[model samples]
Target: MNALQFIETSIEDGIGYIFLNRPKQLNALNRKMVREIVTSMEAFDLDPQVKVILLTGNGKAFSAGADIDEMANDNPINLELTNQFADWDRISLVKKPVIGAVKSFVFGGGFELALSCDFLIAASDTQFSFPEVTLGVMPGAGGTQRLTKLVGKMKALEWILSAERINAKTALQYGFINKIVAPELLMEESVDFARKIAKQPPLAVRLIKESVNKAVDLSLYEGMQFERKNFYILFASEDQKEGMKAFIEKRKPKFTGG
Candidate 1:
C-alpha cells in the first residue's frame, strides 16, 4: 500500500478491485496515488487467482484528474511528466482485462485512466471531459492517443479543444463507454460482466487481448499475420482442446490458465 496513498485494493471471485480512496480530494491523482496504482496493477497481473481487474472510486467522483495543488507553481511540461503519463500506457498493456466502473466526474487524468481500461461501464449520471485545456495544459496521459482511437479524431479533437463535459448517454453514442447503467447498479453490472469473462478460458482471453492490442498499430496484412500466429499458438494449448471438447460434450470447461 506504500506505493499508493489514496487507493485501497481488494480481490475476490477472480476479480481485483482498485479503488480510488481520496474522497476529500475527489479521488485526485497525486504522485503517490499513481505509483500505488501501477504497483497494485503489477501485483494483480502476477496473482494467479485474479482473472479480471476493476478500477473504481470510493466516493462521489471517480477521479478529478491530477492534484492541482501539486502542479500549481511547477513546470507542468517536461520529460518527467511525460514519463508519468507512460505509466498509464503500461497499465493498458497488462494481459488481464481491466474494466472501469465509472460514476460522477471522470475528467482529465481520470478520463485518461478510464480510457486505459479494456472496457468501461459508466453510470447514467457520470460526466466525462478533457478539461486540461481550461487548466492551461493538455492531457499528458495516454488520452491524446487512446481517446482518438476510441472516439475517432474529430470527436476527440472537439472534446479536447472545447474542454466540455459530456453525459454518459452521449459518451455511449460516441463509443467512449461500453455500457451505461444506473448509478446503484454500476458496480454490480461491472462485476457481473467480469465474472462472465472470467468463466472463459484464461489463456484464450490473454491471447485475444494481446493480439487485438498488437494488431491495432499494425497494417491490415500484418495484423492478420499476427492474428494467425496467435491463433496457431492458441491451438497448441491444452485449454483450447478442452474448450472444444467441452463445447461438444455440452459441459463447462474448467480452464487451468495453461
Candidate 2:
C-alpha cells in the first residue's frame, strides 16, 4: 500500500482505518492533508478486502478545520483546489460504509469530513462548529448542504451564523452525531462498532446504505422505485441466498461479498 505523509492507512479484521497523522497542527486539513486523505480513501474503496472504513485523527483534535496559514496567503484559490473538497463526497458514495470517530474539535472542513461518513461515533469531549464565518469565509466544502441534511436547516443556519461551539451532548440531541463515548474509549468503541458492521452481510449493507442515501433526496414514488430496484438486485445476489440459507441452517452466514 502507498504511504500517506499526512495520514495513515491500515486494514485489520476487514476494517480499514485512515488516521490523520498531523498532530502538530491539530490535524488541520490543508491541501496536502486533503489530497492525502482523498488518495487513502480511494485506495480503501478499491480494496475488496476492506469491508468498512474508519476515519479519525491522532492528536488532541479530530481536526481544527482547514489550515489557516494556507488561507492567509495571497495566492488565489482556483476551481481545481476548491473542487478537492469533494473528496468527502466521493468517500460518501463509496460502496462500503465509512465511519467517523471524532474527538476533540470537529469544525469547518473537519465537521464536513465527519458528516460524510454513514455513521459517526464521537467522544463526549468533542466540540463541533462551523466557524468559517469568523474566518471571513463560509464552508467551501459540502458543510452547508450536509449540515442541513444531518441537522435541520434552522439548526444548521444557527451553528453557521452564530459560530457557536456545540458540545457532544447537544450534538446528539440535534442528531448530528450518532453516539458519544468517553474520549479515552473513542477509538476502541469505534473499532468495536465497525467490527459489528463488518460481521453483517457486506452486499446487504452496501445496498442499504445506497438506498437510504438515495431515498432522502428522492421523491416518495421515486424513492420506493429505487428501493425496489435495489431490493430485487440484491435478492438475486449469491450473498442474499447464502444469508437466507445460513439462517435456515441456524449458522452464521459466511459472506464472500458476492
- What pairs collide in candidate 2? none
In angstroms, how far off is 239's CA in candidate 1? 1.3
Return the top candidate by lDDT. Answer: 1
lDDT of 2 at 195: 98
Model 1, clash count?
Answer: 2
* Backbone clash count, each prediction separately: 2, 0
Q: List candidate 2 segments past 4 Å from native.
A: 74-82
Per TM-score, the best of the predicted structures is: 1
* Model 2, global lDDT: 0.87
Candidate 1 lDDT by residue in tens digits, 25-121: 8999987788788788888988998998899999998998889887777764655664666666678668998889999999988998888888999
